[model samples]
Target: MSTENTGSLDTSLVAAAAGALAVMCASASFAGVLADAGWLIPALITVLAVVGVGVLGRRLGWPTVGVVAAQLAGLLVILTVLFASSSAILGVLPGPAAIAELARLLGGTGELIRTGVPPVPADPPLQALVCLGLGVVALLVDLIAVGIGTPAVTGLVLLCVFAIPASLADRMLPWWSFALGGAGYALLLAAAGHHRRWRRYEEPDRVAYALFGRTTAVVAGTAGVIAVLAGSVFTGVGTEGRLPGSVPEEFGGTDGIGLQPFTSLRGQLNRDRVVELFRVRGLQQDSYLRAMTLRKFDPRTGWQLDGLTQGVDANAPLPLPEGTTIGRGRPERIEVQPIGYRDPWLPVFGTPVSVSGMGRNWRYDPAAGIVFTQTNQETRPYTQQVIVPDPSPEELRAARGPMPIDPAYVDASGISPQVAELAQRLTADAPTEFDKAVAVNRFFTDPANGFRYDLTTAPSTGQDALSDFLFRGKRGFCEQYASSMAVLLRSLGIPSRVAIGFTAGYQDGTEQVITTEDAHAWVEAYFPGWGWQTFDPTPLSDGRTALPQFLDTALHPPQTPAPQPGQPRPGPVPGAPAPPVAGAQPDSRDVPQQRREPADRGWSITVLALIVLLACAGAATPLAIREIRRGQRLQAITEGREGAASTAWREVLDEVRDRGHQPRDTDTARQLADRLVTDHDLDATGADALKHLVTAVEREWYAPTAPSDGTLTDTLEAITRSLHHNAPLDLRSRLFPRSALPPWRTTP
Candidate 1:
C-alpha cells in the first residue's frame, strides 16, 4: 500500500479522545448527586461511537460537513439502541415510535432536572439523558478541534461540563475530578501543538521546539487551575450562602415548593450528631409530629409540596378536614419549641384547632393541614390546641368510596403497568377499601415479602425504579416505603397523600425531644366517614415508632372494653406485619442530602443562565481572540516597535488566509501580495497598499540597516479595508477565521 497523509485524521481522533477523558472526569462531580455511576457506561459508549464515525468518514475521503452529519446519525442510532430499542426499527434505527419514546424520556428528565435535589436515583431515563448531553459535547469537540481545526477553543466546552456538578452538588466535588480535567485539557493542547510543530518547522531546532512545547504545557495548566478556582469561588461550594441574592419563597408563583424529603431526611439521619429540632411537651399519648403534607404525586417525581393553604390568623381556629365531625375529635393541648431547625413550614401535632404565642407572620392553612410562614421560620416556642381523631375499627371498615376532595389526591395517571397490576393482585381478596389499604401496607412490612429498611437503596421514583423496589430489590428508607404505599393506594381508587415530619420522638422527662434522626414519612389514606388516617409501612427494628390507635384497634381488638396496661403494644396481629419504623439512620458512610434550609431558587437560575452564556461565548471565542490579537499587532506597528515590517506582512498574510487563500511556505512576500491582488480582483487602493507593504517586508529581510517604515500600519489597514470591500464572504471569515488553525495535509 502506498503511503497516504493520514496525519490529520489521526490527530482528530486524538483530540476527540482528550475530550472524552475530560467529560468523564467532569462527570465524577456527580458521584454523590446520582445514586450510582451506571450513567458513565452509556455516556462513554456515546462519545466513542461519535469518534469512530468521524474517523471512518474521514478515511473514506468525505468532506467535513458529511463527516459531521454521519457522526450525528451514528449518535442517534447508538442512543436508540441503548434507551429506546423497543420502539426502534430493527432495534437499531430510530423510527417514529423511537423518537416519541426518547421525547417522553427527555420530558421526565426535564422534570427531574427542574425539581430534583442532588443524589437523585440513577435510573435508565437519567442515564439516557446524560448520554445524550455528553454525546453532543463529543461531536462539538470533534468538529471544532479536528474539522474546524481550532483545538484551543474546546477548553470552553469542557468548562461547561465541569460547571454543572460544581453548581448542583451538595458537597465539594472530589479533588481528582478537577485534576483529571486539568490534565485532559493540557493533553489536548499538547497534542494540537505537536501537530503544528511538524507542519510549521520542517528543519526544527530541538532546543527552540522543546522550549515552545514546555511553554504550551505551562499555559494550559495555569488556565485549568484558574478555571477550577474561579468556578469554586463563584459557586460557593462549601458555604451556606447563595450567589448574593434571595429567591422568592413561592418560586416565581409556582404552585408547589421544592421538597426533597428523601434526600434531606437521609442526610439528617446520617449526621454524626443527632440534632434536636423540636421539643414537644404536654403529650399524654404518642403521635407523629406533623411538619408538612405533600398532596400531589407525580409519577416522574415521587411527592410534591403542592398548593398553598389559605392563610388564616395564627390564633384563629382552623377548619376541620371534610367529613370530620367537630365534637368527635378528642381535644389535646401541646407545647412545641423549635430549636435548631429553620424552615418555611412549621411542625404541629394532629389537626390544629388554634395556635398561640406565634407572630402574625405565621398562618394556618386548614385545607392543606399545616402551619406556614412566608417571612421566616426562626426558632420560637408556640402552643397548639389540636384534635386527634379516634376512629374505631368498625367505622374505618364501613368507610366507602374514594372520597377525593381534589383529583390530585387520587391521580394515578403515570403509574407503571406492573405496579398497577401488583396493586390489584395484592388487594384482590380484600373485601373493603380499608382492607385493601391494610393489605398493601402488610405486603411491605411482612417479612415473607423480604422487604428490608436499608438507607443505601436508591430512592428513585420512576416506573423502572418502582418495579425494582417492589419486585426485585425490596430495600429502601422511609421515603421509599411511604411514597410506594401512597401510589399503591391511589392505583386502587383511594385518596391518598404522603405526610413528612418527625415521629413521636423518644420521651425525655416531661418533653418528647424530636431529633434530626427522627425525620419520617408515612401514608395518610382518606376514609369517607373519617379524614386522613395514618398508616405506617416502614419496618424499623428500632423502638422509636408509635402505633396509631385506629390501626392497632383494626389489627388486634381488645378482649374486654376496659383498657389493659403493658399488653406488648398488640404485636402486629401475630405475624401479619410489624408497625413501621419512626425514621431512617445512616448506613456505612454519610449520604449527603439536599440542605433543608430555604432553597436558593434565584441562585440556581443564575448558575443555569451563566452556563448557557458560557456555551454561547465559547462558540464566538476564536473570533473575539483573533480580533484582539489583530489590534495589538497593528498598535505595535504604529508605535514603530522592532520587527514592524515583518509584523505588517504577517498580519496581511493571516488576513489572506482567513479569506480562503493559503500562502505556500516557499512563496516570497512579493509573490503572495501579487496573488492576493489578482485573486481578490483588488481595486487601485488595495493594489497600491499591497505594493507598499511588500517593499517594507523585502527591505526588513535583506537590509539590516534599513529604517523602520512609517506608513506600514496605515498600508496594512488600507489593504484590510479593501479586502473586506472586495470579498462577499468576509463575514464568515471573521467569525470562523481559517488562520486560527494550523494547515493540515490529507490524501484521498
Candidate 2:
C-alpha cells in the first residue's frame, strides 16, 4: 500500500476514537438531569461497543452499508444482554422475548420522561434508554467520520447528545463536559486534516509525518485550554454561590413556587433522595403542617386550589374559623425555619392564632388554614401560636349537620358513579358524618381492603382517575388516597377538602426536621362548630408517618361487636383499627424498608457477562473465518495439488489487496508483476519470487503439461515476506483483511 493510503487509514482510526470520546464527554452533561450517576457506565460501554464494531468493519474492508448493519446488530445484542438478558437466548442473542422486553423498557422510559421531573431517579428503564440513545449516536459518529470520511459532521450528533440535559435542566452545561467535548472535536478535525496534508505534499518522509503530528497536537492542546477557560467563565460548575445550573436538594410543586397538589405531590414522593425542607422547634404534638388546600374538583383536572380566596394581613392577629370559639385547651408555640424549601405558601403547623416575624407581603388565609406570600418563603424563621383542638368522637359526630363553609367544598359534581356508589355502600351503617369519614379512611388504609401505597402510578385526577384508584387499581401514594377520600366524603354531603403539606417529620435532636420525602396530602372534614379536622387515609409504606391523636384507639376506643353465647369473641376486625397499623408510627430507630421492587441481582450479572462476551465474539468472527480460509489455500499449495501454481498467484493477489492495493481486472500476469515490484519497491528476493510466479501462471494456462511445482508454497511465501518488509502489516490490517470478504462486500 502507498504512504497516502496508510495515512488515510491512520486518520480513520483516530477519528473513530475521537468520536467515542466526544460522545462520552457530551453524555456527561446528564449529571444535572439525572438524580444519580448510575446511567453513566452503561451509556459509556454502549457507545464504545458501537464504535468498536464500526472500526472493525472498516478495517475488514466491509462497505459502509455493511459496517452500519453490523453496528446496529451489535447495538441490539448489547442492549439485550444488558437490559433484557433474561428474555434472550443464552442472554446474548435477541429473541422475540428480548424484543418485547426492550419495547416494554422503551414504553416505561417514555412515560417517565413525559411525567417525571428533572433529576428523576436513575432507574433501570432510564438507564436502558440512555444506553440505547447514546449507542445510536456513536453509530452516527462512526458512520460519518470513518465511513463517509467526514469528521466535521459528527458535531451535530454530539450537540444533540448534550442538548437533552441542557433542555431538561434549567442550568448551563457542566464546564468540564464542555471542555472535554471541545477537545475531542479539535482532535478529530486535526486528525481528519492530516491525510489531506500528506496527499498535498506527495511525500512519504517520516519527518513530514512527525512534524504534522506535533503541530496538530499543539493546536488541539491550545484549543482545549481556551475551551476550558471559556467554559469555566460561562457555566460556573464549582462556584460557591447558586447558579442557574446548580439545582438545590429541594422539591417544589408542579408549577414553580406554587403547590399544584396532584402532580406536585407525586413528584416529591417519588424523589430519589430525601431533602430537608424545614426545621421546626418546640413542636408540641404530631400534626400535618398545612401549606395550601385544594377544594375545587373537576373531572378533567382532578383537585385544584380555591384560587379566588383572599387573605388578611398575617402580621396582625388571624381570625378563627367562622362560629368557632377559642377553647381553654392549651396552645402550642412553635418556630419554623425554611431550610431548602421554595414555595409561595408558607408551612404552618396548625390553625394559627397569631403569626410574627414574617414580611408584610405574607398573608393569612383563614378559610384554607394557609399562611401565604406572593413571593417565595424566606429562609428567616417565623413564629406561630397555633391550636390543634382535640374533639371527642361523640362531639365530632354531633357537630356534623352542615358547616357554614362554601357549598363548593361539599360539591360532588363530576365524581364517578362507581366511586360515589362505593363510598355510600362503605358508610351505609354509619350514623354520623364523622363515622362516615372514619369508614372511608378505613377502606383505604385497611390492608384487608387491598389498598397498598404505590408510587408507580402516573399522577391523574377526575372521575375516571378516582374510579381507577378506588375500584380497579386499589393502589397509590398519598395524593391518590387524599383525593379519593375527599371526593368520597363530598359524595356523602360532608364539607371536605384535600390539604397539601408535610407530615410530622421525625425528630432530629431538638428540631423536627421536615424533608421533601415527608411531603404529604390528606383529607380535612369540616364540623359545624369545630374547624376543619385532619383525616389521613393513605397507607404509607414508610414508618415515618404519625397518626393523629383522634384516630388513636388507645385514646378513644372503637366499639366492638358482642360475641354469641356459643362462640368465642371474634378477633379484632382486620383493617378496621384506627391506629397502630403496620405503617403507622413505627419505632423511630427502625430503618424503613423501601417499597420499590428489588432487582434480580444474580440474573443481571450473568446476563451482563454474556453480553460482553457476545459483542467481542461478533467482532472476531470475520477475522477468524479469514484466517481459516488462508490456511486452506496455503495447504493446497504445499501439497502440490491440481492448479497449485494458480493458487499461489491468487494468494499473492489477495495479500496485496488486503494491504490497500487493488489490481486492475485487465492487467496481465507480467504487467501485474511489474507494477507490484515498482510500487512496493520489493527487494531482489521478492522480485525473483514474483518473476517465477508470473512465469508459472502463464505456463499453467498455456502449457499443456498442466504445470505443478513442489516449491510453489516457498515462492509465494517469499513474495508475501517482501510485501510485508516493504510496507509492514499492522495488527489492524491483519484483523480486518479486505481480501477475506467478497468483492461486493468491500469498496474495491
Candidate 3:
C-alpha cells in the first residue's frame, strides 16, 4: 500500500477510536451517576482495548470485518480474563469455567437491574455488562463511522445513550454528558470524512482544508445545539410507573419501600437485630403470615401496595375476585397475635375465606388477600379462615377469568426490559399459564440456575429488584425471588402477586410461634377456579423441593387425562382432591395439614462439612508449611548463592525439588549427584550431566572468576529434564514448587 493509503487507514482507525471513546463515555455516564463508579471502569477499559485492537488490525492490513471481529474477540477475552474470578471458578484462562463465569456475570447483572435500584454500589456483573456493552458500541462505531465512512450514523447511538441519564430527573447530571458525547461524535465524523476525501485526491489542498474545517465546525455546532435541546426537553420528563429519577411518597420512593420494605415492614428484617413481631396458633400445619400484597407494580418505582384500597368487613362478605373458584380448597384456620410491631395488614395462611375478630376499620382486597385498617389497629389477636388451594399446576394454568374484570387485578405493563426478556425466555417452552408458573418457579428455586435463599442479600433498593435477583444477585431471600416470579408471570399475561409475611415458624406444640426469621415473601398466581394458588420459589435449606406444589407430583408422578378442547385441567391429586365448587370463595371441607420442616434440621450439612474441612486445612497448613520452609531454608544455605544469580539457581533447584527429588540439608555437591544418579537409573550420559552441573555450580559459587560459558545453565537445564523423566508421578509438585518461595514467607 502507498503512504497515502496507509495514512488514510490510520486516520480512519484513529477517528473510530475517538468515536468509541465518545460512545463509551455517553453510555457509561448513566451507570456512573445512577450507580457507583465501578461500572464505568470496565467501559473505559473497553474503549482503550478497542482502540488498541483496531489500530493493530488496521496496521496488519486486515479487512473491515476482521478488524471489527479482532477488536470484539480480543476485548471479550480480556474482559473475561480480568473478571473471571467474579463469575467463574477453576480459572485456567478461557474454558467451560470462563463461559460459565460470563453467563453468571450476565445473569447477575440482570439480577442487579431487577432487584437493585440505581445509586447502589456497582457490582462485578454490572461492571462486566457495561464493559461488554461498550465494546459492542465501539465495534459498531468503528464499522459504521470509520469502516464505512458514514461517520454521522455513529452519532445516533451516542445520542441515545446520552438521553438515558438526561431523562432520569429534571436534571441531576451536568451538561458534559451531552457536550462530551456530541463533540466527540462530531469530531470523529468530520475527521473521517475529511481524511477520506483527501485520500481520494492523494494530496493535501489549502482550499480542501478550509472546506473541511468549515464543515467540521457546522456539524460540531449542530451536535452541541441538539444535545442542549435534548437535555432541556427530556430531563425530568418522567411520569408515574416509568423509569424516573424520583417516585411519589406512596410508591416507597423516599424510603425504598417497594424493594426494601423491611424498614417498617417487619421488625425482624433489620440487619443488626431481628425482632419478633407476631405469633400464630390453632393450625395443624405451618403457614406464612402475610403483611401486605404488592399488586400494583410500576417500573419507575416498583410494585406498590400503595394503590387504592376498598373497605369491607363482616356485613360485607369480603368481596371475592371475579371468577374465583369455590370448593377447590379445604378450610384452614390460623390465629394471629401481634407482639413487637402493630402492623396493620392481616396475615393469613392462604386465601382468606373469612375473617373474624378484626375491628371495623379493616378493609379487604380480594386481589391481594390484604386486610388493612384505616387507622392503626391495636395489637390484638384475630382468627382467619383460609382456603388452601389444592389445584394441580395444570388447573392453575388452565384457569379462565372474566374478561376485563378490573385493570388493577391484571395490571403489569411496567416490567423492565431485562426482566421481561428473562421471563419470556424462561417460560417460552411452556404453553400454559400453570406451565409457565411452574417453569418460572423451578428456575428461580434451583441453585444450579443462580438463585439462592439468602435474607442477608438485600434486594438493591430503587431499581427493578426482579432483574437484579435473576441476573446479578442470584442470592436473596423470599422477597426477591417471589417478586421476580410474580413480575414474570404478569409479563406473560398471567395474574400474579407477591405476598409478604412470615413463613411457617417454630411450632410450640399446638400453637405455632412465628418469629422474625420466618418472615418471607412468595408468589401467589391468580387462578380462576382455585383463586390464588401458592408457589414458593425460594429454595429452603432442607432437602425438600422449594416447590411444595410440585414436590408430591414429582415424587409420585401423577397420571393425567387427555387434554381438553380449551386448556387441560390439572385437577387436584386423587388422594388429596377437593370437589370443584360454585361459591364465591372456596367451599369448606375436611382439611389435612401438610408436614412441616424440622426447626433445627433445615440448614445444609454438606456446606457445613466443606466449611469444617476448609477450617481444618487452614489450621494445619501453617504447621505443614513450617516443615517445608525448614527444608528449603537449609537447602538455600547449602547452595549459598547470592544476587541475581541466586534467583536463577533457586529457580532451577526448585524445579528439581518439585519433581519428588527432595533436597537434603546434609547432602553436599557429590552426595546429591550420587543420589540423583541412583534415583534416576541414569546411564553414562545422565550421570555425566549430574557431574557437569555439580562442577559448573561449584565454579560459579566458590571460584572468584567463574567461567562465563552458558554450560552452567545448560547443565541445569539437562538436570531439570532428567528430574521430570525420573519422577513422572509428581506433576502436582512441579506446578506448586514449595521451595520456590522464601523461607520466612512460607514459615507460618
Candidate 4:
C-alpha cells in the first residue's frame, strides 16, 4: 500500500483501539459497583489487550489484524471475569450439592416471577464457563455480521440490555450470561468497523466530532450526578412511611388510624380494605402500617417507599399504652419473605412494644401491633425487630373484663339492616358482651366444623361475603376469616376491628423472617379493663398450629455458646469470635513503632542518581561508534584517485545536512557541522569529513553539478563512505537555536 493509505489505516486502527478501551473501562466500572465480585483482573486484561492491539497496529502497519486480535482478546478477558466472579455475582455457586437447594429457593419464588427454576445442586463454575463460552460464540457471530464499528456506543447499548437479565441468569445458567457478553463485544467491534468504513467515503466534519464528544461527556456526567442524588434521597426516610421533609398529619382527623404504605397496586388494595372496613366505626384510630419510611422522594418516581432516607432517629418513642411499663429485654427480630405480591404494609403481632432496625419516620402503635412505612411495591424480603410485651397466661386470662360500648357504636343509619341483623345473630347466644365477642371469634376459628383456609383465589362480590362463607364456600383465607369476625363482633355492640399481619415466619434460631405468602388478617376485640386483644378466627392446619413453620425456624436459628458475663457475645454467626471481648486488656506488643530516616538518602534519590549516570553513558555510545566508522571512510577517500579528498568530505557533510538539519543563521554549513561533531563527541576524522561535506553542499549550490567523472566518482565515494558514521546534527538545535538538543541522532 502507498504511504498515505498506510497512514490512514494506522489512524483508523488507533481510533478503533481507543474505542474498545473506553467500552472495557465502562463495563469494568459498572461491574465493580454492582457485582462486588472479583472482576478487576478480567477488566485489566481486557484493557491491556486493547492497548496491545493498538501497539501492534502501529508497529505492523495493519489495522485489520489489530482489530481481530483485540476482539479475540476482549472476548477471552470477559469470559474469564464472568467465570471467576460468578459465585459472588450470582449468589449461587455451581455444584451438584447446591442444585437442589437452589431449585427449591427458585421454585418457591422465582417461578412466580417468570424466572426459570434452577436445578438442585448446580455446578456454578462449569455453568459460568459454559455460559461464557457461548457468549464468545455469539459475540463472534455478531462481529462477523456487523463488522468493526463504533465500539463504545454499541457496548453501552449491549450493557443496558444485558445487565438485569445476566444478573438473574447468572444464578442458574451462568455460562449463558458469558456467552451473551461475548456476543455484545463482538457486536461492538463489528459496529466500530462499519462506522470506520462509512466515515472513509464521507469524511466526518470536525465540528460534528467536537460537538458529539462534548455532548457525551456532559450528558453522562449529568446523569451520574442525578443517580447519586436520587440514591441519597432514597436512603433517608427510614421506615416510618413518612417522606423526607414532610410532616405527618393524622389520617381522617382524630380517630388515630395512621396512613399505611400505599404505593403499589397491592398496597393500595390493602389500604382501601382497611379504610372501608374501619371508617364507620368512629372509634378506630388513625393507624398506619409502617414498612419503609422515605425521607427522600425521587423527582421521577415521586415520593414512594423504595427510597430509603438514612440517618434518622430510629429509637424515638411512640404513643404509649396507659399504665403499660416498657421492658428492656432483647428485641424480637421479624423477617418478612416476599412471595411475589408487592405491598408496603408488613403484618406483625398486635401491640408491638418498640421497633428497631427500621427507618426513622416509622411510629409505633401501642393499641395495634402494626409497623408501616411508605415504601416501593417491588417484591423483596424485609426485616425488623420489635419488642412484644411479655404477658403471662394468668394476666391474659384474668385481664378479661366487661366490654365498654362506645356511644358511637349505637347508630348504623347508612349501613344496611341485613348487615346489622347478621351481626346480631352471630353474637346472640352470649350474655356478657365479652362472651358475645368470644362467640364471634369461635364461629370463624372452627375450621373443621365451619371455616377453611384456602389461597386458591379471591372472593367475588355482589352477595354478602359473610353469608357465602357461612353457607356456600366453607374454605377461606385470612381476609375472609378476619372480615367475618369483625362483622360478627360489630353486631353485638362490642367494638371490634380487623388486624393484618404475617401468621408466621421462617426461624433462624431466635430470629424470624416473614415471607410475603404469610400475609394474614385477623380480628381485635376491645375489653374494658385490659384493652384490645388479638383474636385469630382462622383455624390451624392439621400439621400446623397458630404459629407458622418458617417463623419457628427463623426465631431460633442454631446457637453457639455464650461468653462469660463480662465477655462480649459472639458474632451473629455461630462459632464466630465476638467482635469485641469484655474485660480483654489491650497489649503493648501489638503497637507499631515509627522509624526516622534521612529523606535525602531515600530510594527516590538513588533512582535519580542512577538515571543521570545512564544518560551520560548513552551520550558516549554514539560517539565511539562514529569514530570507528570514520577511520574506514577516511582510508577509502584518501585511496581514491578520481576526486580530491577535500571535495569528497564536503559532499558527505552536505548529505548529512540535507536529511533534516540546517545551521543557525550566524554559522556556515562547515562551522555548524564542526560544532555538532565536537558537542556530540565525534572523532577527528568524522568531524573533518562532515566539515568537508558541508563545503561540497555550498559549492554545489553556487557552482552546479558539472564536475568531471573523476571528481564526481570521488565525491560520490566520499559521501557513501561515512554516510552512516557520525551522528547527524540535532533537529531541535538546528531549527531553534535556543532549544535543548535531542540526546542522539541516527543518519538516514
lDDT (Cα atoms) of all candidates against the true structure: 0.69, 0.68, 0.57, 0.39
**What are the per-residue Cα lDDT tens digits for candidate 1 across 377-409?**
233688989888787766787876545477778
Predicted structure 3, TM vs. truth: 0.39
The runs of at least 3 residues in candidate 2 whose Cα sits more than 4 Å from the true structure, single-residue gaps closed, are 1-270, 322-328, 400-402, 458-463, 554-748
Q: After superposition, how far is residue 602 of candidate 4 from its true place, in Å?
A: 63
lDDT of 4 at 614: 48
- Candidate order by lDDT, decreasing, is 1, 2, 3, 4
The candidate with the higher lDDT, 1 or 3, is 1
Give the Å shift of residue 737 in candidate 1: 35
Q: Any idea what lDDT model 4 has?
A: 0.39
lDDT of 2 at 506: 89
| Candidate 3 per-residue lDDT over residues 1-748, each given as its tens digit | 5554543334444465567666765774474235457667677777777877876887788998899889877776777766884443444245677877787778876545432323446677777876777777777777766666555556555655655555433233566666666667567765654434332323334323523565455556666666666555444331112221122333255222246333335322432334455667776655556667667666555455645346456325655554475665667777777664444556666667677776666667665567766442343577887766566655555677664334565677766777777777776667666667777776754445645565445447545555555665566555567767777788887877777777776756666665555667777776666666677877676432223454346324556677878996775432232122122222122121222222221132234334443543453344234334433433333344342234334544565555545667677877877876777676676578778766666766778485443444345445554654555434234223445434322221
Query: Which residue runs of candidate 1 sit more than 4 Å off their true CA positions?
Result: 1-270, 400-404, 458-463, 557-748
The residue-level lDDT of candidate 3 at 610 comes to 40
User: TM-score of each candidate?
Assistant: 0.44, 0.44, 0.39, 0.43
